[model samples]
Target: MTLHIYNTLTREKEVFKPINPENVGMYVCGPTVYDFAHIGNARPVIVFDVLYRLLKTLYPKVTYVRNITDVDDKINAKARETGEDIRTITERTAAMFHQDMAALNAGNPDIEPRATEHIAEMIDMIERLIENGNAYEADGHVLFNVPSMPNYGALSRRNMDDMIAGARVEVASYKKDPADFVLWKPSDEDTPGWDSPWGRGRPGWHIECSAMSRKYLGDTFDIHGGGHDLVFPHHENEIAQSCCANKTDKYATYWMHNGHLMVEGEKMSKSLGNFFTVHELLEEVPGEALRFYMLSAQYRSPFDFTKEGVREAKATLDRFYTALRQHADIEADDVAAPDHFVAALKDDLNTPLAISILHELLSAFNKAPSPQTKGHLLACADILGILQQDVEGWFTQNTAADATEVDADQIMGMIEERKNAKANKDFATADKIRDDLDAMGIVLEDGPGGTTWKLK
Candidate 1:
């Protein structure tokens, strides 16, 4: 089956055909490094990560570019408000972003370009826009002319009235039109600035992505992705600037957007106390569990992240790992993922359906454990980027349980003692040991295969 993606540009599921099959290019707008990434920020990171893995499996070469917005007014404002150095804030926050995404099993992009590093490219693109009459400079600032591009709001489908209403709050006296956005703005002595034709000023947010993507993926590319909230001003502006400067009818061939996320049916916000960073959640549940839980819903649908849902996801992974534990002795044969599973993923990354197929594989393996069945089960999980941890590690190295508080090796010793006592027909000692293990939240199971223990 041909892979289909729900393109935000076309507002429909379209069959994905890269401009060049030998190499596939995908660019996703990344975080502006001013603060910790919230759960909302993680949605696109994970959604695209799954897509990235899928692309790698299909194409011989895949170049995934996710840029970092290191130079922004928000970062400067954060420095000013906190009295922290701008470099320190961006460096610290960027490091945290990488750590958090790594925990989610999101691979580092093939090319991670920084906005600050591409200042020259941004200036070049801005200059091209000026020569093309799509942008004009006034009052130490260069702003893109909203009226210059007739189809400016095509992607967002916002008319001039809508754009005016949305952009009214940020209107500047130097702007020719209310909808015109900053391509370059003057930075004060205290703020981070780069020397440009517009004097000592930093590049605007939308222009950063355009310039960076052009430098890496060329003027036109395969796919551009980000969160649904960015469909308006941010993405819309990028399209106008890039297409106008490059003299192309299209900027990106396809656009992909993941829906917003809510916390327990409420909007996730710091004000409501529901905002959670990935690091904070990692303290409560395994990263794999959180990753699995996020894919429970389709990428385009809004997700309600609940504490209970995460716990259930963790338990579900435990069951899958238990099947692996039971068949550990069997040498799994190398096998391809099931066609049905691949078909599910290809159908717009229908992970909920794909996960159902995984459960079917799990159920089949539980009934009859064999090398072939085990390999097939794992192959499916590999595509989903789950169930890779060794079975013993799944039980012993869980974040839900404080490994420091309960030593897994110590619990194994107790189970061994119980086994020896039972063999000696010392029923009293065996029963006492069982009771002690139970009190410690470790449940023991005895069968023909001897004893296996798991946390309650």
Candidate 2:
């Protein structure tokens, strides 16, 4: 089956058609780089990474661009609170974002443009908008004239009243209309600014993405993606600025958005004590487990992340790894994934269905351990970005708070003692050792290879 994506603009699952099939281009809105990315922020990253992997297989080349906004009001606020240089705070936060995302096995984009580096492009776009009469400079600030665009809320499908209320637009005296949004805002000496036609100012939040995406991926690209929350103002403003400046009716051919993410049963928040950053979660749970757990649900479905669910994800991975370990000597063939597995992903990224197919593959491989069967299992897991770790390392690695309490050497020594007891025909002593390890939250499995231990 061909690839199909749920286009937010059309509100339908349509077949994905690239403008140029030889080289597909995709742009996803990245983090603002003012603070650690929370778990809710991770949904789009993991979701799109799977789509990226699938695209690579279907096309000759795929150019993925994810930007970083280094110059923002949030970064400025953080600098003030810490009494640090704006550049210093932005650099540190950007570095942290990269490291944290890398832990999740998210591949780097082909082009990662920063907002500060693209001031020239942003200034040029704003000038074009002004010349086209889509924007005007007022009170040393350039604002997009929403009334100029007849279909201002085309993508969002909202009326002017709903758009204004939803965006909570500033009703400033300088704005020509209440729905008008900023393209460029004057920045003081303390804040980051660049020389432009209007004055020394910085690009608005929405303008940064418009200029960056156009510079990297043409005026109209294959796919533009982000969290669902961005559909109204952030993405809506981007479409307005890009189409007006470029003189094109379409900013992107396809628009995709992932669903919202919650913690347990409530919205993720620091005040609720449920907010978690990917960095902090990595310490307690394996990164692969988090990736797997996130994929367990369909990308477009609202997800309620829970601690118990994360533990189950880890245990499920253990089952797949154990099967591979039992047939360690078999050399898996390099093979493409089963057709049904790829079809599931092609159908608007049905990751939950794809993952369920993985379980069936696992069961099939266990029943008949062959190079061909193993290859099918590994190939399917590759698309999901799971089951890639070393088999033995997966079992021995420590995770969670309790897993660290015990030592690998200590567990191995006890396993050896039990082995000796069983060899001596002392069943009683062997059972006692097994019970003792069980008391300490350890599970021992005896197979033809020998007894292996893992944290329960």
Give Cα-based local distance difference scores for all models: 0.89, 0.91
lDDT of 2: 0.91
Model 2, span 73-115: residue lDDT tens: 9989999999999888888988999998887878889999999
Off by over 4 Å in 1: 167-169, 398-404
Report how far residue 95 has shifted in candidate 2, in Å: 2.2
TM-score of structure candidate 2: 0.95
Model 2 residue pairs with clashes: none
Q: lDDT tens digits, residues 41-74, model 1?
A: 9889888998988888899999999999998888
